[model samples]
Every structure is written in structure tokens, then in C-alpha cells.
Target: MSREKGKEFAEQDLTPMTGAATDVAPLGRQQKPAHELTADEDIDVADWDRVAAMAEFKQLVLAKRKFILPATIFFVVYYFALPALVGYAPGLMSKRVFGVVNVAYLFALSQFFMAWLIAALYVRAANRFDGMAQRIISKLKGGR
Candidate 1:
């Protein structure tokens, strides 16, 4: 597009991100309920109690807990280990593996990669979760 068109395009409103806490909507954005913005497929009409009580739903929740609990614990431990080691084991953290770069720097940098890896893993796991959820929806819709 031309520069002026691009500028005009950039001036257009974007959707307000869901879950943001603010009295006023942010500039160039409008707040809309999720149900209004996306195809529902009657997702909002599912009976909460029945859905929660289903064996598949129970399994799905369990799967999430199993994966999430450990990942959270590991991430927390790994994340805080940096500061803990720096404070408690300064000598170890200070040991230089490469010239001018020490263990502390390397470990800190690894946090970025670690976060990305966890995100990638979660995406894979989320696909399975989505499939489980869809199956439960189908069963609820009498497609079983």
C-alpha cells in the first residue's frame, strides 16, 4: 500500500484485548464480548454441570493439571534458581565458560529459550486439549 494508505490503515481501530482491566477502552480499540466476535457453535449453551461431570471432561482436566502443575513448578524453580544461585552460590555463578561471559549471564539468557520451549510445548498440549474438548462437545450434542 501507499504510505498515506498505510498511515490510514494504521489509524483504524483494533479489537480491545480480552481480560484487560480498564474503565475506558484503550485508544483505537473497541471492547466487544467474545461471544459476539467469534462463531460460538453453541459453546456458550453447554450445560456446565454435565460438561464438568463427564468422564472425558474429567480426563481433560486431569491431563491439564498433570502437565501444568509440573511445568509450573519446574519453571518457577528454574526461574528463581538464577537469583538464588547468584546470591547463595556466587562463586559458581561467576565461573566463566566463555571469555567475558559467566554462568550467570548464560543461565539468564537460557530463560528466554526456556520460556519459548515451554510455550511451544503448551501449544502441542493445547491441541490435544482442544480435541478432548471437541469430543466432549460432540458427546453432549448427542453425537455419541
Candidate 2:
């Protein structure tokens, strides 16, 4: 509405500040016993058992790596390829359509397209990889 009303609303007190400026309270540093909290208890196990548990996790990691490597390569290639194309093709990207926005600039901006592309690929890959890992884990853990 009016500027003064807006200013007044903006200047309104939000929350109670704790103590003086020098007496700053630690934010979210509260300590509580494990049983007192709702969070799941951290299970303690031997290193060997941890390693054994990670066997399926290792396979999942490998599968993820497979996707990441290819996606990363594609992302890099796509990001740089437009600049290269513009470099080699002079005025190719300089063709202005709607105001100063040029084809080259738009092509460069298409890096977002590559990002989405890579993200989609990674998601699909991870899903498949996770499914495989789940199967393996279920078999190993006796249909868990």
C-alpha cells in the first residue's frame, strides 16, 4: 500500500533476540542423550563388518561412477562446444533476433540444457544401479 505503511511493516519486530550482542548464544548446539532424541541410534559395528556391509554399496558406487563419467564428459563437451562453434563460425552466433540476444549467447546458455540432460541420465542410471544393488542386498541379507 502506502510507502509509510510498507516501511512500518518492514520495521516490525520478528522474533526475540537472545541476550546482548557480546552474549551470543550458540545456535542449534544443544546436546541430548541418544535415547532422549527421536533420531535413530548410531549402530556400532567392527571394521570388518562395515566393510562387508559396504560390499553391495561398492557395486552401487561403481555403477554410479559409470553414469557420472559419461555424464561429466557430455557436460564438459556441451559447455565448451558452443564457444568452439562460435569461435570457428564467426557471426554465426552474432545474429541478433529479439533485441541484443544473439544466437551464440543463446547457444552458450544452452549449457543449462546439457545440465538437465546429464541430470536426467544420472537419475536413470542411478535408479537402475540402485535397483540392481537392492536385489543383490536382498539376496545377501536373506530377502531383507
Candidate 3:
């Protein structure tokens, strides 16, 4: 509305416009103050560096690299190959597949399916990674 009305509304709003409301807890649950919450936690802030250096963490990194690197390489190659084929091997790519759909067009369309397939595969692999990460964190926390 008017600038004065806007200013009045802004003044009436109790919530801060920026940054998270640290005082509020979920579902109307009463939370301890920030300092108290940090003090009561079992994790030591100093040990975070040590946790990152742990063998379990290294294994997690290696596992992710193993899956992600190959998937990335594969997708990059497949995605580029379509255009490369169209440019370099135009005759081959121009060959009709269905009625008017050429090999190049089919290959380009298959990229969408390839992307979805890669995403699905990554999600499956990431679930395993999540389990590994949780185990590593649990070990670091001196739990199960």
C-alpha cells in the first residue's frame, strides 16, 4: 500500500526479516538457549578435524570418488558424442530411424533418458554413501 502503511506493517512484524530465528524450536517445543544447547551436546568442536582425518571418512571419500568420477566421465562423453557425431559423421547421423526422425535426433533424444538413468543410478549409490557416512559419524561420536 502506501509507504507509511508499509513502514507501520514492518514495525508491527516481530520476526526479523533476515537470518534464521535461533530462539524458535520446531512444533512449539521449548528449546534450551543457544549457549546451553551447545554446552550440552556430546560432540567436541575441536575433534571435527580429527573426525575428517579418520579412516572411515577416507573410505567414504574414496567410495564417492569411485562412483561419481566414472559417472561424470560417462555422462560427459555421452552428452558430447551426440553433437560430435552430428558434426563429424553427418551422413551416418542423417540416416532415417523411424519416419522423419534421424539417427542424430534419436541420439539427442536418448540423452534425456541417459541423464535420467544416470540420476537414478546416482541416487541409488548415494543411499549407500549415506549409510556409510552415518556409520562413520556414529563411530566418530563413540556410538554404535
Candidate 4:
């Protein structure tokens, strides 16, 4: 298309399908300019530093580390155990279960379930972590 036509298209008012004039901003909702955005207005660095240094924060971090490190180690071991077993003992892995279905296939399939269970557990733990974090924020804000 021509530059003028393109410019016209760009400048065209996008009316709703109902053909009624709406209060919505043209082209879409108006957004605040980056410089005008005050997303960090309530965040005090000193308060954040103080909260980070608190024993509560340290406990929170340690708690997360304790859970996550062990969980990660467990998952890694569990995930790799299948391959190691298959490689080391192909005869055992090849053994039939119900008709043609083998042990290896069942074990591989179980990995999917294991991953989903881990994710669910992580979500539950994360909810607790969120509560801890909120408490820390509240303490910093002098609300607790």
C-alpha cells in the first residue's frame, strides 16, 4: 500500500463491532509512559535490606534450601535410576508385565507421574514460602 494509505490506516479509529462510540482509548487502552510509572514507589531499599538481614529471612532461605536441595537431589537420582537400571540390567527391564508391556516402559511412564507429583508438592511449598515472604514484608512495613 501507499505511505499515505498506510498512514490513514494507522490513524483510523477502531470502532467496536456494535458500531457504538465507546469510552475506550483509541487503538487500545492508553498506557502510562515508562518514566511516569511509579511501580517502585512503595519499595524502600533500607527497609528491604533490613528485612533481608533479619533472622526470619535467614530461616526462610534455609527452609527453602533444605526442601529444594533434597527434593532436587531425589528427583535427579530417581530420574537417572531408570536409565542406569535399564543399561545395567536390560534383562530385568525387558521383562513383560501385562502381555507385551515391559518393566522399563512402566518405569518410564511413572516418571511423568513423579514429575507431576513433584510439581504439586512444590506449589504447596511455594504457598507456604509466599506466606513467609508476606510476613517478612509486613514486618518491614511495621504492620506486624
Candidate 5:
């Protein structure tokens, strides 16, 4: 296409499709450059500032961070420690266990269980986070 045609196509008003629109976050929305958009653009977030400012929301963020930060740190340390021990402490890792299996093999196998355990813990924690979010939503909707 010609540059002028491309420009016209880019600037053309594309109306959202009829039907299948939701009360929140309607589909087929046209995206524009941030610089080209007006400051007062209607993005349809209802009282988002109030939501962000709500004590419940703040607590929810904090609760998430509390679980996530420690979990992330633990996982990173546990994961990196395997390679470090193998590379630095070969004698310790080479100690035979169960005839053929060794410490390194056992440790490597344990990682799978560790990952599963962490995932299970995260799922449990996520349920609490979801409840916290639901409470915040309820507050926004003028409920207890």
C-alpha cells in the first residue's frame, strides 16, 4: 500500500464490534500510540485510584509479596546450590548411597520433589490471595 493509504488506514476510526461486549473490558478495542492519545481518554477503569488506595488492596499486595519473595529466594538458592555443590564439593556429592545411587543423584532427584512441594505451597497461598482479592472486590461493590 502507498504511504498515504497506510496513513489513512492508520488514522481511520475503527468502531468496536457489535455484541460480545462485557461490562468490564469490552473487546475489539482500538489501540493507539500513547503520545498521540489525549490525556482524558476513556479507558473504562472505574475508580481505580480508590481501588489502589484501599487498605484491603494494599494488604493483598503485601501478603502476595510476603509469600512470593521468600518462595522465590528459597527456590533460587535451592536450585543454584545443586550445581555449586557438584562443582565445588565433588567428594561429598560422590558418596555412594543405595549401592549404585550417590549423594548427587539423590540431591538431583530431590529437586523434583522440592519443586512439587513449592508448587503445592504456592497453590495453597494463591487460594488465600484470591480470597483477599475477592474481599477487595466486595468492598468496591459496597459489600462487607
Candidate 6:
């Protein structure tokens, strides 16, 4: 093909396809640079000022608070409820299904597993919460 034809073809190929547009995050969506924060380190005020000005940053802060409250409530309820149920309702819950292992016995034993599972879940969730909190704080404080 002629150079002119090639150029025209390239231009045509570059045209946006109907309903096929890909989502592209702007450059700002990328991760912020790392910073070593210490108790005595001086903070950069400009970054915080910029972040505080953003609506998305405010939403993130609010969302974190929203999740934390419910997570705390759930943790309290499940933590207390499981133990209490196991202790008080053992007879009611008792049922032999696997040899001599009763439902109550299983429920009591399962609490240990439940504790570990809850801990693991909380650790993962809290880590994410910590990240958002730190990000919001850093943005407010002007840290990278």
C-alpha cells in the first residue's frame, strides 16, 4: 500500500469502537511514593492540603468509619455470642452425629477454629482499613 493509504488506515484504526471503549485510570490513580515516617519527622503540608480538597478523599474517610463501626459491632456480637451459646446451650445443642462427638462438643471445639478464622479475617480487614486510614492521613498531612 502507498504511504498515504497506510497513514489513512492507521488513522481509521485509531477511531474509538462503539461500546468498546476501555476504562483508563488517569495517572493520579497510581500508587503514591513511599516515605519513611517517624515520630519526629517534619510533615509536608501541601499534599494534605491537596487531598483534603478532594471529594473522593472525604468519601474514603467516611467509608472507613462506616466499615469500622459495623466490624466492631460484629466482632463484639460474635465473640460473646459464640462462647455464651457454647456454654449455656450445650445440652440443647447436643446431638451425636459422629461416633461420640456431640454437637455441643463440636460447637465448643469449633469456637477455637472460629477464633482463629475471626482473627485472620479481622487482620485482613484491619490491614485494608489501616491502609486507607494511612492514605487519607498521609494525603491530609502531605506525606507520600
Lowest summed lDDT window (length 10), candidate 1: 1-10
Q: Which candidate achieves the best TM-score against the true structure?
A: 5
Q: Which stretches of candidate 2 lie over 4 Å from their true place?
A: 1-62, 82-90, 97-101
For residue 136, what is the lDDT in candidate 4? 76
> On lDDT, who's better, 1 or 6?
1
Model 5 lDDT, residue 86, Cα:
100
Give the TM-score of each candidate.
0.67, 0.47, 0.67, 0.65, 0.70, 0.44
Off by over 4 Å in 4: 1-44, 47-49
Cα deviation at 18, candidate 2, in Å, is 32
Full ranking by TM-score: 5, 1, 3, 4, 2, 6
List, in order, the clash count of every candidate structure: 0, 1, 0, 0, 0, 2
In model 4, the Cα lDDT at residue 11 comes to 42
Q: Deviation in angstroms for 9 in model 4?
A: 50
Off by over 4 Å in 6: 1-61, 79-91
Clash count, predicted structure 3: 0
- CA RMSD (A), model 4: 14.8
As for candidate 3, its clashing pairs are: none
Q: 95-140, model 4: which lDDT tens digit per residue?
A: 9998999999999999999999999999999899999987876664
Per-prediction RMSD in angstroms? 14.8, 18.7, 15.1, 14.8, 11.7, 17.0
TM-score result, candidate 3: 0.67
Residue range 10-124, candidate 2, lDDT tens digits: 3433222334455533448563333334446432211224334666767777878877887788778878788688888867778997799988878777788768877887788
Question: Residue 131: error of model 5 in Å?
Answer: 0.8
Clashing pairs in 2: 93-104
Task: State in Å the error of residue 130, model 3.
Answer: 0.6
lDDT of 4 at 132: 90
lDDT of 1 by residue, 1-144 (tens): 122332333343322345646444345555344444456432333345555767999999999999899999999999999999999999999999999899999999999999999999999999999999888766655523
For residues 1-144, what per-residue lDDT tens digits would candidate 3 score against the true structure? 122332333334322233356544335545444343455553232244554677888899999999999999999999999889989999999999899989988999999999999999999999999999878756644422
